[model samples]
Target: MPENTPYSLPKDSKAWQQAVDSIASLLPEDISLHDFDALQSLPVFALIVVLPAKVPALDIHHYVQSWVDEQPSWHLVTVAEDAEASFVDVDVATNGSTGTQQPFTPAQVFRYLLVPVTDTLMHPGKKTAAAHIIDDQLTTRLRHDLAKNYANAQATDHPENAALVHDNLVDCHILSIGHMLRTHKLACFDMDSTLIEQEVIVELAKTAGVGAEVEAITEAAMRGEIDFDESFVKRVALLEGISTSVLDEICARLTLSTGAHTTITALKALGYHTVLVSGGFSYFANYIAKQLGIDEVHANHLDIEDGQVTGHIQLPIVNGAKKAAIAQHTAEHLNIEMSQVVCVGDGANDLPMMAIADLGVAYNAKPIVQARADAAVNVTGLEGVLYALGYPALVASKS
Candidate 1:
């Protein structure tokens, strides 16, 4: 190996000592390089994250998996082909002299880790126990919680705070393993504030001279502070007697979410089923779905008379329960399991449907929604959901 090759540490060097210390910090005080083999034989499973080389500096084959019957592990160097090299390896000298044996070499990309879900990691204390240091590498043990609680706990509560604790290397979460990407046949989306940028009712409220009032109620419902049913009715009543001309104008001006086009088109091209299940009005839902090439739509129907707003919705409001039922029925109708579905949304109304799907993603969601979701995509657009469905980062980036 070249003298200057990065991440290549000479045997018995200071860097090597620091590296060993880092790994040991994630484990018990007595564990060391000798314990690696024994630990690999433990009868437990963990959620492993191999961040693919999404960024140039992070050019490692990244992936995540949770299969039972396998031992818990933090692999620094697993076998990956051109795009499969996920972790860093420590190629140490085996001859007990200067650079004699070939251990795995690890890049700065997380070599591998074995962290237990300590209370401190999940619910960080007000201040660090130790003083801040420039060369620190933050680590959280993804131990054998086997259950998805570890991922969910880290995600729901001030996950961003954890990122700051790690100096921002932590991007998102992969809590539970969903159905394999290949099995995904259907993708369901919420319309207001999710599939589309603005809430249909809130936009309609603007034209009805009650924008502030409706917007307040909409925000409250989305945050789970107010019941979605009551909030929906109150907002609609405020729109009474509004002209239909406003509906058309608002629908015409409606915009798709930033990455919605890329996500929907990619799904269709790949032959995946796509649908819009919204608590928003059918008129707007259908309009957005048609434009996005969505296959179906189920939404609230607004009653109108003489081209003036009646503000009365027809039977079977698409509340949270209805949203989930629609998702289930769609899956059964397509002869697929709930595990084959991918649900994405931004509000409390979206949670039920998201819960039942194989992979439920909260996209730029309210704090309450993000906390409970299996995964949350706070930094990106709808295309981020594709990544949650196990799509290649390259595939999502193209969108």
Candidate 2:
């Protein structure tokens, strides 16, 4: 009612227009407004404004406090820079009365865990048990329950003893959270030993009768014990005398890792631009991409001569650095920020691309890869990623 107070005005009111205009005018020229919403459920008037990132000089607290000095019951406001950040209002009634109220801070800490669905059904208390280990006061929400018998949980106020909590849960596979979980747009995957169950080259080697030799090289390279390029050349040389038809046989037998299809389907359905970047040959990556309906594919090309393997690969191999570059290039092409990309792989070479992505998930990865990744998924299949992104069980099931 006072002229100096910050009061709530009707959406159509000129007062509201002036307030919006004033805020916009105060923002820096480079800063852009992303979203603004009025709280409809809250009893008191409140507004939430979303910006791109933190701004040092944009202090709305001082502006609102000055107005509050005049009109005690005017309105409350908050600003958030993170796109996925949200606020939840909590009201507590004292002495069994409903009028008095207090608000708690927004839920900042987030936890992600995976448990066997059968275990959860058999022991429903397991969910509560895991929650207690994180934070007794916090609540856990079901993110996803895969058809493969695993379920994902998201919780607030995650404890500092997160690793201990994960260790306590017998069936729990992954436990991770933070900015990476909230903001990811693209999902990139490595081909060999990641999306698929085995290395295509090793399979080809088996057909060439050099399986033992090639497999050893592949393992050493993936473990980061040997240079990928050097290992690739040695492995390819072993397949030189093998006929090109071996590729068809290998592709026919290529088995996707558990939940690979479901994971890609869910990611695409959620509006992610899926890509397959591999050090493996396009001979296999292209076929897999088509079958999986991936949006993009980048991989090496194996040289062939006279209907047989030439034992030589094309230049500019899709090594770790190349994979990272492709991931960045794809993000630019999609016009999405790098913070929106999620990369998943299993070997050392996949580390570079994973590092560039907002969330790097090691899917049954080697020790070195897992150590460097933002998160690791060992027990569940690829679909576990939906849980990492905080998708609800029902939502992933529907996908």
Candidate 3:
């Protein structure tokens, strides 16, 4: 086995054949072809490493493999690399007969780095001729150990991307082949600070002559110093008597988060059912959802009377609890399991839904949000969310 480098997925058709040969080597000389069925039933995991496009494919395999070495329990069966992500087979996950496939354990989840590594690194090497190989069943202990390794990896920084800020780490994530084969059908996102770059409520407050008060209250809510419902009520009350036209004016000037269009397009193309679930007004969530091609929206409705802000909310405010309920109902209605539900947001209120989601994403979120979510994306754009969902160009080369 190589000292540091770990195994990676096959890069192309030729390397893929070599990988099959490695498995064949484990069989006895007189083993019959009928025994191949056992291999199919055996669990398999791909240590998908997504690097910045500028980085050489070989470095990506090496960078992640090195980290895998630190984990004592698992071993690379074989190592190969590719410049493009394997055909995800998006249709294969959602369409056709899936009854035959074995169900993955709920403990098994799709995990990834929020921001992929870039051209720079502290230790760069190539895939080696050998790997720290191991053959073990998918036992409960192994599963628990692998999960622990993932947590350790995230807390431990990569050789590169250890910058104080403006960093991208060689973050390695594991997902069972079973989970990977299931279609992630629903995508729920918070409107303010997520789809769009600004907070719609704060924008409305600025126009309503309550900008300072609202911003202060919003910051306090994020800081967990005040309750979301109370802060929201106080903030909205300050916007009383504002013209309804202000809603349209604020929506027109807001900018979508960087790489938002690309991320949403990629999700839709992959056949995901996109939904906007925000604590902000339906007025803004609906507008942004339309522009991004999102399928549905759930948000708090702001009350207006005589073409002016009434500063009152309709019943059932969409707080953290409501967000989780919405996500749960959406999954049930769509016939998708909670394992296929993904929630992305950037504030304290978004945490509840994230907690219940299959994959919780904190996008350019506060430090506390980043600490708690399944994954956090602060250095990169909205496209980083795609990486968390197994969409990055996981590159590699022949070992």
- Give all candidates' CA lDDT scores: 0.58, 0.56, 0.59
lDDT of 3 by residue, 1-399 (tens): 112221122112233323434544343445332333332233334343433332223333343445456555334554343344343221111101112121110111122211112211111111110110211122222333433443455446553532322123232334333233345788999988888888888999889888998999999888677899999899888989989877787777887776565567667766789999998999888888887779999998889899998988787989888999999999999998887888999999999989887678888788788656766664356766766564433222234
Point to the candidate with the largest TM-score.
3
lDDT score for candidate 2 against the true structure:
0.56
Top-scoring candidate (lDDT): 3
Best-to-worst ranking by lDDT: 3, 1, 2
Q: Write the per-residue lDDT of candidate 2 for residues 170-236, one digit (tens) a residue.
A: 1122222223124457899998888788899899899989999999999999999999989988998
Question: Whose lDDT is higher: candidate 1's or candidate 2's?
Answer: 1
Count of backbone collisions within predicted model 3: 4
Candidate 3 deviant stretches above 4 angstroms: 1-63, 76-179, 394-399
Which ranges in model 1 have alpha carbons more than 4 Å from their true place?
A: 1-170, 395-399
Return the TM-score for candidate 2, rounded to 2 decimals: 0.58
- In lDDT terms, how accurate is model 1? 0.58
- Compute the lDDT of residue 113 as modeled in candidate 2: 20
| Per-residue lDDT of model 1, residues 135-167, tens digit only | 121112222221233234445675753333221
Of 2 and 3, which scores higher on lDDT? 3
